[model samples]
Target chain A: MPKVGMEPIRRAALVQATIDEIGASGSLDVTVSQIAKRAGMSSALAHHYFGGKEQIFLAAMRHTLAVYAAEVRGALGMADSPRTRIEAIVRAGFGTTNFRREVVSAWLNFYVLAQTSGEAGRLLNVYQRRLHANLLYNLRPLVGDKAEEVAQRIGGLIDGIYLREALGTKTTNGSKATAMVLAALDLELGQGK
Target chain B: MPKVGMEPIRRAALVQATIDEIGASGSLDVTVSQIAKRAGMSSALAHHYFGGKEQIFLAAMRHTLAVYAAEVRGALGMADSPRTRIEAIVRAGFGTTNFRREVVSAWLNFYVLAQTSGEAGRLLNVYQRRLHANLLYNLRPLVGDKAEEVAQRIGGLIDGIYLREALGTKTTNGSKATAMVLAALDLELGQGK
Candidate 1:
């Protein structure tokens, strides 16, 4: 029997293990047993907590999104102006915590998983919408009526940088990634003016 | 016994079938048998032709790259200036045939596969390198010393648009996608001046 208060710790362990396992394999082709082994728990215990691999993956996805959301929120809080807010959001995206190889790999695989899993797909949509809304809100003060379009480009560029990084085509350089995006933001803002 | 001229035709069919299957399922979690059935052939024939799913997938990736290369080549031949050449390349990325949902889906899965398969990774590298070279070649006359950075931004934008499209968050609007990338190009060129 498990002790009280152990469930949350075990679930967190399992979720982190899921991310690490997916990162190592570079895909969602991992089994519950592998994740369980990595978490240092029995497959049965992992199953008892998360039901199966899909649930475990979803939990991991949720955790990744939560971390990202917190980063964005923290950055936004520190931003004093609209343009600065935009910079903050872009910087948060390429921040060390979210831009690690393992996290990026998990993100790419999650995008793939969203195709077949309804829950995963819904979670992805939520993330996309929030990101878009955040950009749009900040962009309106800078780009005026073209805020939506400019927001889309910035968002796309951020996602694009992540995808490129995931392929290992370029070394994972967060500052470089941040510069590419900020340059795009600069161009968009300049054109809008 | 098989006919002598039938090999190329069968291989082409299998490649197309493979793209369709991945697109329909939205992942590389597909089986050779499913692809074979989709091609209206037996599993043994698919196995005999490609040996396994990975080869079939690699072949499909090759076909996608070939088609994209041909489109860019055809477009570049018609371009009369360096700036127009850049336009030609960007437009070719969002061209009607290449921008179809199935092809885009295949491209995304291929990125995932590249992480695990050496051949897939090599093919992807070749595509990325060629794209960068083509963009750098044209961007030189316009941006001078900044050509490489400009080219990287443009390439990343094109890819970013495709990644966004794959999630089905927005309709697969090639014209809109093309416009966003071209706008980025325009901004980059304007800045370089």
Candidate 2:
């Protein structure tokens, strides 16, 4: 029973170690031995949980995404207004300020990795679609009849913004920038700017 | 020197051959020899014009982006209203049906590569920034006091759309889905849908 209780913690520790390595070294290609050394666990333990590098890598990616999805949902649910909700989602997307820069960089790096592999690529796409779907679901009511087209435009701009910000442009802080994007959507739909 | 000419056609032909190779075999790492063979030129002749693999790749990318950028600018310019311009830009971003799937797929693959290395990465960011800046400039007359914020938001959505679309999910393309995103923005801004 005690050994069973240790399993999740050990796996979690492995994932955390992987995240750390990626953040520090700007890559996720560090070996299980590297992760095990960092986690202070025997390499056998790493193998026991993950079976291989692919499994461990999957765990790390899934863990990061799960946290992201939960935070994004929480952000959307936190505020009453759509604008505030969108801002919250954007802020949540940035994760925490202390770990923000490295976390974002790591996420982007993993995303590119996900894009390369067929199986992992499919998984990442599903997760992202759901994330955007949730945003669209929250946004549908306010946009009325033109909601679909409006969403297309908004979605485009959001993608455009992340690429810019991720590349060191830093157009504005998360909250303010979200507000501006929302406002433009209104203007684009023939609503007030 | 005058026979083959310093004309756009030679470069265009070389770019076409490179594009075909890139699409058939994933990755932009096509060799100068490979490209020269496809372009019906001797290896030395190819080197004479393009120098090396990186240079050839950059030239091909530039050629591709130039085509895309022109289409986008034309689409936007045709519209008198900012709202209409937004619509045109979105359509242009998705690209046309002719090479839509191939081109978009290639672009997404390149995007991942650009995240890692080479002139392609640099060009990717530069072209995006230039486009965003241009959008901001055009958006100024429409947004007025809130111009900057609107620009950033617009930029984000634009980037977001491509990321979502490239993931090849119906969610990024659906009406009810996209509307929700726009609605969320509208409600956040306290504007009517």
Candidate topping TM-score: 1
The lDDT for every candidate, in the order shown, is 0.90, 0.63
Model 2, B142: alpha-carbon shift in Å? Answer: 2.9
Q: Write the per-residue lDDT of candidate 1 for residues B29-93, one digit (tens) a residue.
A: 89998999999899899999898878999999999999999999999999989999999998899
Q: Compose the digit string of candidate 2's lDDT tens values, residues B132-158.
A: 676676666765655566555655665
lDDT per residue for candidate 2 within A1-193, as digits (tens), equals: 3455888889999998887776555555467888898998888989998898877777887887788888877777778886567556656765464125456555655655664567667668767667566567656776665555655565556555555554544544566545656566557546563
What digit string (tens of lDDT, one per residue) describes model 1 on residues A34-138? 999999999999989988878899999999999999999999999999999999999999999999888898999999998889999999999999999999999
Model 1 accuracy (lDDT, Cα): 0.90
TM-scores, each model vs. reference: 0.96, 0.68
Native-to-model Cα distance after best TM-score fit, residue A15 in candidate 2, in Å: 3.3
DockQ list for all candidates: 0.62, 0.29
* Alpha carbon lDDT at A70, candidate 1: 99
Q: A-chain TM-score in candidate 2?
A: 0.78
Q: Cα lDDT for residue A23, model 1?
A: 91
